[model samples]
Target: MERVIGGSDRSAVGGRVPACPGPQAPGQGAVARSVTVRLDRRSLRGWHIRLLDQLGQRPDRRVRIAWVTQGSGLPGNAEVLFRLEAAIHGLPRPGLATAAEPVALAPYEARPDETVQTGDDIILDVSGAPAAPAAAPVWRLDFDGVPGEAGLLAALFARRAPVAALRGPDGAPVAVGRLGAESHTVMLAAFEDYLARTITLIAAALDGAGSPTLPDGAEAPLQPGRTFDLDGFGAGRRAAGGLARQVARRLYALCFQGPQWRVGWRQVVGPDLIDLRRHPEGGWNDLPDDGRRFYADPFAIARDGAVTLFVEEFDYRRGKGVISAVGFEAGGPRGRPEPVLELETHLSYPFVFEADGQAWMIPESHASGTIDLYRATAFPRGWVHEAVLVDGVVASDATLLQHNGRWWLFATVRTGGGSYSDTLHLWHAPHFRGPWTPHRRNPVLIDVGSARAAGPVVARGGALIRPVQDCRGGYGAALGLARILRLDEEGYAQRVETRLGPGAAWPGSRLHMLSAAGGLEFIDGSRPARPRLLR
Candidate 1:
């Protein structure tokens, strides 16, 4: 089953998500404080309502919303674009309402906030220039180098500019991000996704742990500080073509499932993709699977003179995934994968490794809002719940690494209401089992193309090599190898060195995972598959 953004419509009834723990200052904890949000009265959107409710729900703050009438509203064509895209895309109209009418604000007593006026032409003063280093009393949103939503349409639909939150007075960017969409064909869905992430960015900024630099762009650099004019970019013509393609895609899905994933394995004599930086010759051998289920996220281990491979077995009938394993002998899989672990919630990315002289697995259990540890009592099958490493988080592909006498957990988290991949979060602990502390800079990176972990982190030549999923094209559409340049308590960083995708060597449209153990390498990708009856 497809997984969309979680908790998107929570604002409908003022639902509350768990508040992100803000980083404590050098000597001060997050004490309760009064916060007033300044907004443009004319361009109120559903995200604004959600943002206010989110801030108000924080226990560390008393929140109130104030509307100012001095800012420009959304462009004249924004509503027209939304209505047309909604009709063409068949999106959830009620839940994906981008435009919202002004609602009653909570009664709040006025406070004395020092204000500075800019002549009589009030341009919604929050922060002024891109180079200002000081902060103002209020906050404002900027799109395509302008205040308010004057350039929102051209930015999102045309230029694809980075969104920024500027503090008043100096307008310095606390959080700046280059947003992305799951699919560009559906304009409505893309628009909603951008707004969801935008809210997450602002919330982080308010918490004082905001990132000062732009998220790392592995394939390309992001110019979040650049300014451009608010001009048209032929959005009308592009919309017409997108509508036609979207309709065709829907019609095709009616006859068959969208795509099915499968695992591929091959024996290697020397260095694998980690060192070669290219696909091995003679292609790969398929790990056969039954027509009812597909396998992905292959993780392997070599122990006691035996090599075992684990994968995420997703059955079409059940609509959920479970962990399974297959042994390799004589340079080939022994048989089809057998169910090794199952749970009430969906599971994938079975990150299996040896710790404390025993086998342990940390599968993706973000569906249950926790990252858990399981110990194997009977080798690969008898798994017991050991402990909860991290809680109250929707983290995917939880990969663990032990470096410099400290255990670090890496995963891409779904911040508030956004895509499953994009925002990368880090947590560190003394051991793999006990209490885990979130990094001071929670979201260390936010690039959709290279944020999500695809497989294990391997050590080679005193440097950590990470396998990441390139989701810029789509979820798991390609794979990349990044060199972890610096990873410590102070901060974390990586530079993507190589990217690989499906082509002549791999006859598919998607190539996602990569892992190696005992001279055996494994990878997975997508291909077309049909039901038994249809086949």
Candidate 2:
């Protein structure tokens, strides 16, 4: 629900990225051509107008708008539910001032004198459709594999499907994304995030040189089985529960942190999680934490004799996180985690490792708008700032791996206005510290279920395995292991081979972040816990 894409306004992270121009063919007369976008005047919302504004601002491509005045609008209860939830939660109310006003479309609508015509080279239909006829190749914006406003309504009201995508006229997928609602209790926030992602997907598809394909055996297209009722039955039923749900949530927040994450670890033998593809027979041992705080994003390193574990220690009273470390011997943890690195800005995912005979850390500093390197000047404590690997972008959980004589930096970027856990961006450099170059296709992948970095990329068998956070259920709801098949200057690719979630072994509602070192494996998951006062 953050202000993502508006008229040339900057995002929380940085400046607005211009829309991608429609791809041009390779020929003597090669140049990006105009595309016709058909929209429903009746259902026109702020997002539709935003999308059109983006397309019109395409640097090299022109846009023609076609109005569908006869198109059906969303369920009446849709806006009602959004307003109800916003009022109770005190959520960000973007465009609420003119929520009831009709959008003026005359400025954007194609005039009769325009050179481009509908049903020409390509028709990008966003309206509830009898899609444009076969005369032109059509790229239809869909939600849960159903086109237009109805598709979004079906997912929000009927199926409540977490996954969404864009499909071509032939039903082949152009881009697929998981809805990123850290909690699904609020429907409007999730839909707004989805709309932001819609903009990113459409832009990428338009500008990408070659056809984009989902990873082999990845998320299959979701079918919203029965068409959603436009009569508002589902939306009406959901709205009726709003008051009760809001009251219950308020009571819950009074006593406990919405989600208190914890770390779990256990000694391993020959094969680790990357090898076994399942949890070990003996369940994990809890890494203890005081009731006043929670620990998460575990990473480990083997030193001369013992293993040191690093984590993000978040204090309830302070409401900020800092890097903490603990040492482990044969029996258990040396003691409680001690603060190792505290900064003015929030930090997490203490990505620690050894190189050049010195310990180093790259704690996620996305909130500061920089990815920094810190050298342990005095072993575990006395850390000193070393270098800034990348800046000017909000990058999360930056995991680094040296492969094929290159250092590959992987992290999910908060591009435009979508979930910070969905779009995967890559940067590489000859050394770990300097001169990083972004991949030609910067956002190599956009998958909410398996895009964010969970932990380090390690080698297994003859292949490289990367740990990714599966955020479809929500951010850090699950963990996944992906096989890095191709990664180089030209392109990047990966296949999610396995996904693990909380169960009897983990005993939590969320499981995310995986790491292993010195015959010890580490993981983290969410557990509900009341505040110290309540306890």
Candidate 3:
């Protein structure tokens, strides 16, 4: 037997049942029960209609849903309805021998506004009411309809060290449900991407399918003692302003304050690996380039007693980067850096390696939506396109390493318009250049601080050390040295050992890239530049 309960008015479902139905008899066909929810037709909105449509798609017949319509004037009434629909969809199905248990409809209590105290400083205002407890010491989230906010709160609440609660506008406790966050410009392309990702997140959260956190590790809130106020940063203010003001701000940024990156190098003396902490403060050499063009992502290789350095030469006027290299000896560059490879699209992170007695380079060509491979025909300069390792993806900073007779490629990828610096994806191949396959756990890591590949992977004393960029402060804010604990087809994991920031040791505003070869280490940092204005 199947039943549909609708609101306090039992008249909708032909009044209340004489008694709750029990287990079904044997040899009966599968009984599928679906409840068609009907909100007040006069108050039906787009979201309400969408909720009903989603609920109508359930195939299970043995499940039950508690339908309640109480306190229609509550601030989060619509949100509650949405959450109820999600909860109903999440319920387990009843077995063939027994009927599903009855779902009890709970009444929503509406009260006056009050302040709720929490350990974390985030203030959530539902319907402009501030009713929350004052003595709790756990991370508190204002149960408002915001994308990414639910996952953030859920992660904090999962810690369980402190008490957490979700309250409604009337200051009544409520159950946490699906939440998502998305933002975009007025452009149709941008809005489409944002909508697609927002839908994916909402479905995943409600279904309990994937990780319960944002890709950029939004779950990990700002560390204690370090305060970051979104209001103080003016981000909220700008978002609330008129579209003209936003356009003006963007134009100003484009005309001035463009990114300018420069590469720096230091000579190491012995066979032992360089202890990055003890690196000297001075004697750092800067790569030479014209003001219109900047160089970064320094990768060096020594072959037949000759050392050559490869870098990404970015031309600001053209807004693209091409691979360039220069000969380096003991003191400094043997000659001016020359362009070794050019592509129509932007490229960086010239990851060069030797395999099967052939030189190969995998430059960051995410702009082309492909990870490509290039083979050197004439050693240092002459290069030819070998193959497309991975296609139809936006990936950056691909670094390859050989371990246990298999090759692994690590790179940060953008998924459904998410942040490019957070989700790390891996692929493995029997050889360096052909027949590559994605790792079972494609995005093995999701952390803004250590997801992007910054430099080459090195083995030191049986431990694999990887250089990663920490972008919490901003993109390329600092560099982190992470040790890979486990890496295989099934999974991947790493732990950051130490972090290096730009200060007395390296006099710059940002330090991002790190690479070592032939007793020399190279890094890149950014410094503030005075933009030239044309009268």
**CA-only RMSD, every prediction:** 17.4, 16.7, 19.3
- The global Cα lDDT (0 to 1) of model 3 is 0.54
Candidate 2 per-residue C-alpha lDDT over 1-535 given as tens digits, one digit per residue, 9 for 90 to 100 = 1111112211224454453344443111232245666665445666765666676665456565665544544543355455435534556554321121122344444344443333355566676545434455666665554455545545554536545555565565555655554445566676676677666666555544313344454653444354333222233233334433443333334325444579999888767888888887787898987666779999999987779999999765454689999998757799999999999766799999898899999999765667899999877899999999997777889988999999989988874335678899999999998689999998999999888999999888789999999987766788999999999999999999999988777776788989988888999987654453442
Model 1 Cα lDDT, one tens digit per residue, 1-535: 1111111111224555454356552112232244545555455556666766765565545554444443455433344345435533445443333554342232222343533222211112221112221122434456434554443344544636445544333445544666666765555577677767767766666665556556563221222444332211223223333433433333234224434578989999776888888888878888887655679899999988999999999765454688999999756998878999999766899999998899999999765668999999988799999998988787889999999999999999874456668899999999998689999998999998889999999999988999999987766779999999989988989999999999778877789999988889999997654543332
Worst 10 residues of 2 by lDDT: 1-10
Give the alpha-carbon lDDT of every model: 0.66, 0.68, 0.54
Assess candidate 1 and give its lDDT.
0.66
What is the number of residue pairs that collide in model 2? 0
Off by over 4 Å in 3: 1-259, 270-274, 530-535
Model 1 CA deviation exceeding 4 Å by range: 1-258, 528-535
Better of 1 and 2 by lDDT: 2
